[model samples]
Target: MKFEILQFPLAKSAYGGIILPMEEENKSEIFQSPTQYESRLSRPKNQFAPKKIFIILFSIVIVGLIIFGTTRFFAGGKSEQNSEPAPTAEAFPTDIPEPTEEISPTQEPKKPTPTKIPTPKPTVNPVDKTTGLDRSNLSIHVLNGSGAGRASKKASDFLESLGYNVIQIGNAENFNYEKTTIQIKSAKEEFLSLLKKDLSSNYSLGTTSADLASDSRPDTIVIVGKE
Candidate 1:
């Protein structure tokens, strides 16, 4: 008699290793090598590789920021050196002004003039020609009929002081006479009135001549008494 050979179907495992199919009754007895089992277990660790690549890209970004900040700091210092300084204050002038004209010396003072005075005139006495006896040129005779001592001389001196021309001074015919009398020898009322005013009020008057002689007669005669 002749025998036939059978061929089985092949399949791949999850770790990319080759596997053979077995019957259900012998499935528990199937086994793999240690290397193959480790390979299959480490396959899950490859999923964390993307995390390391991200760390490298982040380090490059930080280095770019540091280089940009250093360039700006050096450029700002160079701009400050090229700028201008602030301006200083200006000063004022101190000049003085000159005079317009020169001064002259003072002039001398003038002299003063003198004034003149006038001379005065002499006074003249007024005259009345109606009476024969003029007041400025009258002849008077005084008698002391009262018999008092020096009475006639006293009356004569008084008449001379008053500007009268006393021709005689003597005692009367009688000393027993009571009141005094005035006799006007020239018969002039104006002279008579003037002689009466000069004598006392108690004395009486008459136009007739006294006991005197004609040659010894005066323009007016006054007789003084005790009354």
Candidate 2:
């Protein structure tokens, strides 16, 4: 009693054979969807992940900077912010003006006393016309202040270096600076000229050009000359 499946031959069969019916065969099941298609349609998304990570990193950096700044600000030992002083317009002044101060009485200013210049006694001699030979205050007579002519400049330089004031007087080139000689025509003529000059300035220069060369003075004559 062995049972086996039999199949029946159709057209072109050499002989008829036994065949199994469709209802007698068993069937296997299959999935409703394709695995590859399902997997592709349900794939995971990654687009916003990097953006989220960057946002998080940026937020962390900002927080870190803020924390670092705050920590340094306190540890650096800086003074606390101070409240502003009250404005003068808002605060009452400690010093107040009185009614008398506002209405100060008007008064006249006193006149300055006149200063009296001392009256000089009349002197026979007059003031001499003088000029400073150099930058020094020492003055000399004549249109040209030096008697040594241009040579007087050297004498002036020597006198200035010696800290002495020197002024030379002459109508013409009368003194030879190299020789230190007065080429005067006469002692009398020189004396008279000096006398007249001394009388004019209340200053006496000399009797002769030689007399004025050195610091010398005629005691009787108010005008004196430096020999």
Candidate 3:
């Protein structure tokens, strides 16, 4: 620190035309007070601090508002979806009428029942050609001409055992035959051979006649005599 002294006319006029030298710092002190200078220097710093604080508060408010708006928007959309109605099943009708069948006006007449013509049942004659010469179809009448008791009956039983249909057994008109005689109806003449075959083992065969009428009920007549 050095000091330099200078004098101005205003100082000279005040000091009676004598010039004086003064330091630059002392001149500056003479123009401004220390309190005013100190206050002026701190003013920019105070204003800058308040501006930064204001900016931070404004950013925080803006972020909070944006977050609130976004949250509200999503919440409102979810509420709308939840509030919509769900679909339901349809109900069945209960009072439907039953269908009816219709009858026609012009029905056809019923056909008359066909008359059952009684077909003549086939007559199953015992001596038909179909039943040719079996013993069961040969009706026999035995007569004992041997004057022996039960001779005709024994002949009749023997013929029946051979499957001949023996219709009667009795004594003949006369006991004069000495051997067996066979008489057969012409309608049953086909059975003569079979009867001879059956009686040949038991009695000697005598005269044989095939002249009996066709209407005779017995197909054969036999007269038994002494063996």
Best by lDDT: 3
Local distance difference test, per candidate?
Answer: 0.67, 0.40, 0.82
- Identify the leading candidate in terms of TM-score: 3
lDDT of 2 by residue, 1-227 (tens): 99998756433212353333333233112212356558867999766678899999999999999999999898665444344454675666587666663433685556899999998644322223352122233333322222433433443343334333345533433231222222122322333443343234422233334334333321111112222
Instruction: For each of the candidates, give the backbone clash count.
Output: 0, 25, 5
Instruction: Give per-model TM-scores.
Output: 0.36, 0.19, 0.42
Q: Which pairs of residues collide in candidate 1?
A: none
Per-residue accuracy of model 3 over 1-227 as CA lDDT, tens digit each: 99989746445433255435577678665545667778878886435577899999999999999999999999999999999989999999899789976656686656899999998645333332543656787889999999998999999878777677899999999989999999999887888887887799999999998997778778899999898
Query: What residue runs in model 2 are displaced by over 4 Å at the alpha carbon?
Result: 1-30, 35-47, 78-227
Worst 10 residues of 2 by lDDT: 218-227
lDDT per residue (tens digit) for residues 83-107 in model 1 = 7566878788867787666444574
Q: Is candidate 2 or candidate 3 better by lDDT?
A: 3
lDDT of 2: 0.40
